[model samples]
Target: MIYNEISKVIDNKEIAENIFEAHLSSDNLSKIAKPGQFINILPSSSFDKTMRRPMSLSYQDSNSFKIIYKPIGDGTRIMRSWKEGDSADIIGPLGNAWEVSKNKEAILLGGGVGIAPILNLYNNIESTHPSHLFFGARKKEEHFIDHNPDKNIYISTDDGSAGIKGNLFEAMKSIFDINDFKDKSIYVCGPPMMMEAVRKFSVEHDIECHLALETIMACGIGICQGCTVEKCSDESSTDTYRNKYELVCMDGPIYKANEVKTCLL
Candidate 1:
């Protein structure tokens, strides 16, 4: 079920370089929210910004949920100024959750701020399952996860400042061959290029892959018809008047890699 509520801010602070983490109290939203689902939050109560900003859920418990984001524009910049006791008009638990495979090992890939959903997926699955995380960023300082010896985590940066010098694919290639991932399921959320590369690689190797897509959203619901992605199976569609496009906000943010075309924005 979807919810529209005025959630109260429990805590808000900058955790990394330009990245802010905020916790909002919402009992219903928190309980039903799943990995790869997101919330749409209005920066202010007034009509200065009509469109709400969509943010992926990074963590959640019984009474509150956490969102990690980078303030890249006016809406998010206003969100950065939000503090404790502030009320945010939000709609959420939108989009589908990741279809986690219980029998297979899991491989999670994330980049930059896209790590929000990936982290959420990991936190949900890592406890009882075997999971590996491959996280990438432009620079070493841009990464949110600190170096920890206990986690099955790998890091890569564009510059040679972090673990692997190249992209996430490079880091994955160094550790495992195609045969090593035969029994694994891959989940990815990141920039367009990164997701595209992973999609191609997954197809080439016949690996099972799922992607959490990111796009500009207006309504965060299907009413606006603003966030549509071309469906991969359009050739079989019977509807000729309308193109075979799915709304990202309602139908997905999570889709099987083979179910949609790659390089989704």
Candidate 2:
């Protein structure tokens, strides 16, 4: 179920270069927040920023949840000042979640701040399912590399500052043969270019792949119709959705790689 309420901050700290992780207390909300779902948070009660900021849920426990973000915008800039004991108006657990396959090994990819949701998925499924993570960033400092010692972790940076010093595909190719992905399900959350590349690679290999999209949202719910993306022409036209477009806030934040025309928009 969806919820709109005031949640208190439990902790907020800078985890990486410009990335900040905030823990919020929300018993019921946390209980239902899935790996790919997101929340819209009002950074402050003031009218300076009318629209709430949509953020992915990075982690969740029994009584609280976490959001990891970079304070690069006005709303998020205000969010940086928020401390423990502060209250935030939030609406969540929104959007569809990653449909993980129990039968196939999971290959996860995350780029930049998009790693938040991917990390959430990894935390939830790594214990029982075999999973691998390929994380990429522009520089060494921007990457979040801390993980369980036993977990399969791969790293890449555009500038060769860390790990493979290349893109995700480069990193993957170095350690994994094409056959290694034979029965694996790929899940990705990243910049449009990265997602598009992964989508093409997945299609070429005929592997099952899912993408968690990042787009500007006027409303976290489907009400505003502001987060629309062109649908693939081959997608079946439903009576209520025959317009050749899909609302990212409602229909997805998550979609099968082949289901959408392109993520480059």
* Model 1 backbone overlap count: 0
What is residue 104's positional error in candidate 1, in angstroms?
Answer: 0.7
Model 1: how far residue 98 lies from native, Å: 0.4
lDDT of 1 by residue, 98-157 (tens): 999999999888888888899988999889999999888888888777644257798888
Q: Quick one: best TM-score, which candidate?
A: 1
Give the TM-score comparing model 2 with the true structure, all chains together: 0.93
User: What is the C-alpha local distance difference test score of each model?
Assistant: 0.86, 0.86
Checking candidate 2 for backbone clashes, the offending pairs are none
